[model samples]
Target: MSVVIPVSADWLTLREPADAAARSHSLARRAARLVHPPAVVHDLGSGTGSMMRWLAPQLPAPQTWVLHDWNADLLAHAAAEPPASVSDVDSRVGHLEHLGADDLSGASLVVTSALLDVLSADEVEAIVAACVRAGAPALFALTVAGRVDIDPVDPGDRLFEAAFNDHQRRVAHGRRLLGPDAVAVAAELFRAAGWSVRTDASPWRLGGDPALVGEWLEGWLAAAVEERPALTEWADEYARTRAAQLAAGRLRVAVHHHDLLAWPA
Candidate 1:
């Protein structure tokens, strides 16, 4: 069975601003130029419709959105909270791997956020192939590159980072996740299939949000300890120091990510 993590709407809402700022403006414009006057966008693994909320104003008006997610509640929330520029909203409840040309049939563009790293190589290939078959431009943003930086650096930072990445690469349900290696593989796969791909740095430079920092830090250390159980001995103290720094406004976080736009050559 897959070890899928359930994300609450509150968490999605909390991260929306950071996501909005980290997305590549140039790439979004390039995608917007693909279709004139109006566009039909299919967002894969859309969480609380943050992708739609971010991209709608950047593109032209009269847009239609089809949001896909495994959570029925998220789908309902997305459909109910259509952006002002959106002409209509449709929700599809399913896994990203099940996405196909048929699902993207009327879409002018495809988009997803913070999703690629958790997917297996085969799943990414399938999604790319489906996009190719559908003749749509795909913009995938905020894919983790397995790099993390925290202010007042601890000597154990690298250890935790490596452990976390190892955890990400773990196989579940017989599929090996690409983890931090996702960006390189995705770019190569798209290119080999005759798609022109452009990429931009979209790192999250986080500070001054203790709540977000605490939550993110908790998840980060949890995964690290899961991969390297030995880290558990040091985890509590490390997290305590980090949390104190964050509370005192002395913490800074830099999480490296990349945004890619793939289209027919």
Candidate 2:
């Protein structure tokens, strides 16, 4: 008998939350170079201010943080109790589509985590333009076009991922598509306009994790592969294999990808 497992709203929003927690910490440090001390940081789509939690302390004192998200609950979670030594906390509650002309007047760093993959191409360019106009460097992480896996020995993993990616691109309103591939494309988008760009690996791995994330991953891949008529046979096989893997607790997930450290040139 199969049982339904309740998942957290935050976890539901992400296929790999643990990866953000584990991998993004180190990625924050390297991204700090583009953004110096005494900075006013805008963690756009700052769900629970995770990036602020990762990037703030490593920089100078009196660091003001602005956490922005459409979800008021998420903004409150990030705003109500800020990290120690934070100068002040401001929360922006609105859709990311409207972020371009909003009042990010004095930002020193424009940071985002795992948020860019959900945007359209026009939105990305708009965001890049906004950050450029804001005159602050951006330490963006985990744009889906740049998924990176470290030492992934599983051959079937990439096959499954490729299928899943195809599914994401076909999503309606052009949602959840990889805006670009390879880290260089993102870098060049900024670099072409003369912004300095740097990149590093912030890929996430389970490393023998025994958690329900596997169940979520199974559902995600299953839905993606199952979407295609041509891949229907493979989808059945993949779903069966992944389901069995989940039931027996032998499943783990890996997120390999590039992190962009960008600012206006």
Candidate RMSDs in Å, in order, are: 1.3, 5.7
Reference-based lDDT, each prediction = 0.87, 0.65
lDDT of 2 at 106: 86
The segments of candidate 1 whose C-alpha lies over 4 angstroms from its true place after superposition are: 1-5
> What TM-score would each prediction reach against the true structure?
0.96, 0.80
In the range 1-265, model 1's lDDT, one tens digit per residue, is 3325478999998888888988999999998888666789999888799999999998888999988898989888878878899999988888877777998997799998988898999888888888989998899999998999888889989999999999889987898999888878888988998999999989887896777778788999999998889889799989888878887899999888999999988
TM-score of predicted structure 1: 0.96
- lDDT for predicted candidate 2 compared with the true structure: 0.65
* Clash count for each candidate, listed in order shown: 0, 4
